[model samples]
Target: MKHSILLVEDEQKIAEGIMDYMNGGEAEYETCFTWADDGDKALELVYENEYDLVLLDIMLPGADGFEICKAIRAKSYVPVIFLTARGREEDRLYGYDIGCDDYVVKPFSMAELSAKIMSFLRRSKGLWEKKSSIEAYDIVIYPDKLQVFVAGNEVRLAPKEYAMLKYFMEHRGMLITRDDLLVRLWGYDYEGSDRVVDNHIKKLRQALGEPGKKIKTVFAKGYRMD
Candidate 1:
């Protein structure tokens, strides 16, 4: 699959250069680049389409890259890299504080930036592979097939229920909030209430039978798969 990236940079020349380098066949995987010249447009694009990674410039017309990164983090776990001319120690620290996966300074070599992107991509791929299929508590989950088996017995589940279960299994020990599930599974455009998450979780647990006890509910919080 071709990985899509959103490049949010105000400088047209710099943006084009980065695009050329990324599309120049340096990486092993195919890449599709989408450019956003302003911060507002960047935010709009992120909400409209899913991206594998985001390259943001610190300086922008409508909003700064830091603000954009913060907004993205609030909704999604997409990898973000700050490509900016601001190379100060405090600036880099702030970028990390706001959850940027990587920070690259201006005048950076395209080769180095490309390597950084590839590294993150590889790590993301590894995580996906690790979570793709998991066997726990006598329950087996095949995320790609959307199938779940308990003690060798196939369990039928609705589409949403399957997705919710897969997400819970992937993040087994994490305290996943309802908003996190909404954003990860339903996307930012979902207009439904948070109660939808609760309903799905209930159905998912019921479908898995005895093994479903691994999915624990934290009162006033969200569900967690043990």
Candidate 2:
């Protein structure tokens, strides 16, 4: 799936380079951008649709990135990263004060920027952790950061997939029926086939890869993680 990002920068060439480099970059998950060269246009697009992430420049045409960030924070929890030439310690702190998920100074490495974007996206979707790590087999779940590791390599999963993994790990060895999953995870109001549980579980297992064998299928019933 493509990660939708909003790039709000005034410089023409820099914006183009970012869009081209990031869109063409080899990422675990692809990234696509909607470019807004000025702050007014950025806010306009922000109001138009929801984005997975926003890359904002501090100095802009209409409202500054900080103002845009404040407006964004007032309504949405989407991850915002400040992309600016300002490298002062105070500036970085203020950006953080205004709910900036990350601060990237200008003339930065595109590869490093790409990594930061992916990390934030993972954090945003991995439920942004709090608790300590939970381990089973070679799979480790860190609720503190909401990160998963398989054989010590970090793995990123969609929110639902992460939830399914956690639930399975928590209820290891128990016969969890599809209906149970539907009610507990998908909610009682979910109007869909119980097969949706299977589909999610399939994706979850695929994410786990070789370690996925830890999640056992219980013929026609649901699943067991042991």
Candidate 3:
């Protein structure tokens, strides 16, 4: 089956290139490329169409990426990939804050874009099919709705924190590395330090309480929730 994609970009050339690569190629998955030059139209398309993924350019004509992302998050968690100019830390953070699933700076390679698309698709599939409520001993993960409730009380978690915890729960007892977490949670263009992962883990542990120590840190490696 072809996976539908909503591509919002004002640039014609770049948009064409992406469409050709994604839809014109002979890949394992099929892609339906839908384009929008502005935010208002993008929002319309989102509500009107059933897209599995959204490739959003931050700078739009009518509506900006941030606004579009916020609107989308209000209704759906369909994976959102932000396309913007590099070196805009604030913009990238804003995208993530508004529930963006990934970020890719401008002038990026088509291969990189395709790889990121596939990665998110895989992650989304895994997340959607997850049990409605995840209970690994005392650690509970509500994968279906992107919520975490530990020990009967819902624990508010950041986007990255939720992704991290979900990954750990899905692969319990596995030794996840900083690189692994960075790539999986933040994607290829992640600029923050691995310390971010540590901080989130610390927060997760604290929220889990009681058996918070269950998330063992493997010295110089990473962490595992066992």
Candidate 4:
């Protein structure tokens, strides 16, 4: 399904421009731009609807973008990309602090914004459309299907565990560090520690069973699938 998007901007010209850009044939977005003259109206709409993304402007009549962002972050981790004329370093840092996924400065290219939006969506969903299958020794990983077979027998794995194993199978013989696994599988912005990777690895190993060297621990580095 096409993800729904909410755009909250007070300026009519700027809001129309962005809406047009988003609705253009080149842009593959099923977006609903909510042109709110004030933040209060935008916040109300946010509370009323479940949107996949929010494009917020910094300066608004009622609550302001920062306040609205904080309010949204309190309830949801919905992808937020700020669209504003405020290009100050402090404003950027504050936006990031409040969990803004991206900040686009004014006079930015619509094409670039579209690309950024696509990138964020892909990362958020881990939307790997390519169906990939890898066979490493006695283990087989089917990424598209989110299934695994160990020694030709179906073995159940958790979602994250399956992603980890699939990573290993594709990068067989490569010594992947804890950081590498965390970023690739969990996401680059994941706040969790490397211990999460270790825990998931343990689960993956247990699921794969004996001949677990298919997923080998490389001492201080991390893991390798041989």
Note the Cα lDDT for every prediction shown: 0.80, 0.80, 0.77, 0.75
The residue ranges of model 2 lying beyond 4 angstroms of the native Cα positions read 126-226
Clashing pairs in 3: 39-63
Expressed as tens digits, the lDDT of each residue in 1-226 for candidate 1 is 9888899999999999988888888777788999999999998987788778899999999988999999998866677999999998668767766667677999999998998887667546445336556677887887668778989998988888877776665455657777667766776556789998888887877888887788898888888776
Q: Tens-digit lDDT track for model 2 on 34-141?
A: 999888888888888878889999999998999899988876767788999999866876776566767799889988888877766764643423236667789889
- Could you give me the TM-score of model 2 versus the true structure? 0.56
lDDT order of candidates, top first:
1, 2, 3, 4
> Model 4 — TM-score against the truth?
0.56
How do the predictions measure up, each by TM-score?
0.57, 0.56, 0.67, 0.56
* Segments in model 4 whose C-alpha atoms lie over 4 Å from true places: 125-226
- How well is each residue in 65-161 modelled by candidate 4, as lDDT tens digits? 9998998887766778899999986687677667676778897898898877765565443222333656667877776577788889989988888
Counting clashing residue pairs in each candidate, in order, gives 0, 1, 1, 0
Regions of model 3 farther than 4 Å from truth: 126-140, 143-226
Candidate 1: deviation at residue 192, Å? 44
- The model with the greater lDDT, 1 or 3, is 1
